[model samples]
Target: MPAVLAHAFAPHSHDSATKTDAALESSRHGLRALVISFAALMATAALQAVIVARSGSVALLGDTLHNLADALTALPLGVAFWLGRRAATRRFTYGYGRAEDLAGIVIVALIAASAALAGYQAVKRLIDPAEVRLLGLVAAAGVVGFAGNELVARYRIRVGRRIGSAALVADGLHARTDGLTSLAVVLSAAGAALGLPLADPIIGLLITIAICLVLKDAARQICHRLMDAVDPALVETAERILAGVPGVENVGAVRLRWIGHALRAEVEIAVRHDATLLQAHAVAVAAEHRLIHELPHLRAATVHADPDGPPGADHHAILSAHR
Candidate 1:
């Protein structure tokens, strides 16, 4: 008998109620991170806006716009986290976890739009050069922007990685880039102080370029998540764990994927051909238990136990025609 253990009914493991509570806790952590970071960024942007108005620094203006956009990005991610708490339905059997991926898409779009707007503003300023006033205030504002963004970046990245959220990690990287570009605003202020009027717009253009680079990276990460790509190291770890399980002759195909921040696995293992149905079922349940306990963020796994038939015996030959 082929013993197949499904995720929902995997015995001797975390129950469905426990899984639901864990998921809700994870979502709450994500939402808390977003809210705090959003507040920090908004305050930073508001301060930079005041400085931009007084100093007329195009570089500072570009940096402020990026900060504002970064703050606004929290909205979609917060929505994604909230939606992820919903139970899986028949129509959407996988649940609302993919909403995080969609939020990542929206984040990428927002980044692209910010880059375009910043580039356009810089080019316009270059064509019509103007004096950047209050150089001291502009430099001070740049420093403040860097401090705020760096703090938020560290917090977001820490929580994101802990929760296995690709979107949150990407957003943290975005914030880090914004921090580096904020320093460029200080350089523009220095250039203006040295009597070079064109430095402000030139630095603005450079900031735009930096934003584009960040956009490329964030887009790549989000696209990879959307494509169901996981780390090769994780696959290796799973294989190793399954191979170490008792009563398994060999480990065969092992597939893994991310549904939201959680991981799901499908595994095939071989058992003794003479094993009774109860024995095969025990092995399958054991395999599932080992996987859920060992893997990080692994919500569930399905283990299919196959009989270790004699060497020339084909167990799946009947399905060969379909393939």
Candidate 2:
């Protein structure tokens, strides 16, 4: 498995109990916001689509598609919220905490794809301009949609960030797209009203470009996490956890990865062969607790103890009799 990076993505919780208060509360509130936002966006997009179709406005049509894309983002997060609460299984021991992250990745990809489609259509329309009627109505609709989505996006982002849910963050990105699409429509309408026929298609392409840029960062983050790209600072954090323990001489093999929203680790520690099972278990338990305390995302830990001294050494972490 690839090493997940700490900075690029929200922490993983591959092993923690999602039943915990913070996770539960965050998921609840964030999911609620996403559901409402998605509903409102769907309605708004329908309205915008109707208006744009009637007027033959490329910018308004693109914005409408953007609003529809919000549904794709919100629906996945809602499912992840419910699924993430399930217990770990034999088939998938890590639990479903990562389902939300996967959902986020899918959502970002959807938005980016929508943007690409919009840009292509906009360019085609620019090549063969159509005479659109009633520029004022398109502008009016955009203003109303912008105001509505702005409120929803702002509130959703605040709640999502509080609980560290990437699903909600991706949903917030959807809402933000609506806000920006509205802003673009407003500019396009103004230019249309001022007798600039090219503004509508131009704004459509601009909105599409913005979506691509935003999604690129999100894609990079998802790819890095899946690749287990650990960073210098997080590795340093792991090193500190091992070095500080009382009986540990050094950590030999440190296999650390984000376990969902938590860090899961397997470490080999150097210790004296004279150490009893009880002593070693205690040390390992202490180290596990400290690792969890230091990194809130750590879900599970296994510490293997290796003898400090000679080649003809007695077992330290596990006895041969037990083996």
Candidate 3:
């Protein structure tokens, strides 16, 4: 026998139905978070906009724009979650999980655009200094902005971690960055009230730099997801699980990848050459069972049982040509 491949998926089983329900529930949770966070952020931005118009504060204006952009990111992520709920079609074997990663790309682009706009506005104000009026209101708006963004950040990070969503987590981090920049606006107000006339524009430039840092972090996360990268600890855990299985002489290549927020694994294990086909199949099934139960967020796994032939005898010689 070449190898026995056992898959954890069984369409007609109750277990499969449960898994499907769980996936849909996760999508619903993602959409709910997006909607609530979106509303909160929009409200915060609107309040800031009013202050920006009255005070003519460049720093507050930049913070307001970033808040608006961050709120809009929810649109793409919401659509991605909805698409993820769709059933897999014949042409698309993996379903629409990849839509989340694509949404992440759009989010990164938006962050970059906001950063550029903020930078330009800051530089312009720096060249031609403008008097920032209503210093008190600007300071109050900054405090409000910080409060709102921090709340949204906490909520998003909580839900994102629960659902294993990289995009949502990245967005949450982005919101936290917005909160920090919003605090900078208060410093600008203080500088204006004191003696430094250039403090408002200088703070605006600092806010722009903060946005750039956030952009870099978000881009890195999205790129990792697109590249199918998983935590090394997951692989190590999988190997330990397989090695503990009865009749598994050795564990070979083990791979894990995220399909959206869920995980899928492929594993190879060596069994005694004298074992019968049924024995090998049983071992493969056991390994798959253990993996699914122990691995967090693992939706399914395919286990392959290879016969442990003599050291010099190459069992894969026949398939060498194909390779």
Candidate 4:
């Protein structure tokens, strides 16, 4: 049996007080981005809702509702980010970073609800068709909606990627779909003006279906995060970093997971069997240092040093199966 020495380090080598302050600052930045995007989408939805009321265009109404739903996603995400700033309690030693994943689930549900509501409204209008009025104003409103959603989408996606917030990125993609739905409204307005009155409801149905597709995608991403699935490329990056460290004979299991917008990893490395405990520990520390420097979005890491040998059943055991 190989002697395995394992150590876990909190975000960086900073003191507890410094780590707390840093986490708080990160949450603040995420909150700021969420707030700004929320405001922009709300304004856009409000403007579109006014036109929906006056023109009674089912397509525009569907688009407006989706925009509003997308905007509301900011609330859960903002709360999650705020919660992420809180210090770890005895009950939750890993802190509140997992809140972001839970919030993502809420966002997915909101998206599904918006799609269902829109689909119902569109189907109702199709059964009892309403005469759409103010064709020109409705078209202009569609243009405004498109412009606003596109702007918000760009901002949200840019900031979300910058901060590695998957929920924010999903929300941004949601806005992008809203922008396309707005375009569908524009086409419907043109069709209505051409004496095809049923076009509005038809386009509304299309928008509803489009939203459902986006919901599928968003749910997939959020579910993946909740399940702790990480990109293979990231694993490869970790392995390469570990291999480069001096005194490291080989890299073993490299596990990674997202904790909110940040990443935490568990790395297993092998050192020479003859190496002293102190030397092996030094190598683990060096590997951790390199990983923190090289890995993007890394928040914390746990390194386990194992002696290089044929194999150890204890080491090869599944994580849950092990004691």
Best lDDT among the predictions, by candidate number: 1
- In the range 1-323, model 2's lDDT, one tens digit per residue, is 12222111112222345435555565577678877887787888878888987888888887777778876678877787777766679987877777766776777778887888889889998999776678889888788778767877887787766665544654576577678778888898888888888988999898888777767766876676677655557667877887899987667777776534445677777755567655655666566667766754455666666556666666444666675
Question: Candidates ranked by TM-score, best first?
Answer: 1, 3, 4, 2
- Choose 2 or 4, whichever is better by lDDT: 4
Q: Pick by TM-score: which candidate is best? A: 1
Compared with the true structure, what per-residue lDDT tens digits does model 4 show for residues 1-323? 24333332121231245545656777787898889988988998899899889999989999999999999999999999988987778999888999999999899899899999999999999999989999998898889888989998988888888777878877888888899899999999999999998999999999999999999999899889989999999999999999999999999889999989888888888888778766877887888888876888777777877778655535445775654
C-alpha RMSD in Å of predicted model 3 compared with the true structure: 2.8
- Where model 1 places Cα greater than 4 Å from the true spot, the runs are 1-15
User: TM per model?
Assistant: 0.95, 0.77, 0.94, 0.91
- Lowest summed lDDT across 10 adjacent residues in model 1 is found at 1-10
Full ranking by lDDT: 1, 3, 4, 2
User: For candidate 3, what is the lDDT?
Assistant: 0.89
Which parts of model 3 have CA positions greater than 4 angstroms off?
Answer: 1-15
For residues 117-218, write the lDDT of model 1, one tens digit per residue.
Answer: 999989999999999999999999999999999999999999998988878888998899999999999999999999999999999999999999999998
- Give the C-alpha lDDT of model 4: 0.85
Give Cα-based local distance difference scores for all models: 0.90, 0.71, 0.89, 0.85
Whole-model lDDT for model 2 versus the true structure? 0.71
Kindly provide the TM-score of model 1 when superposed on the true structure, using C-alpha atoms. 0.95
lDDT of 2 at 122: 94
Error of 4 at 214 (Å): 0.7
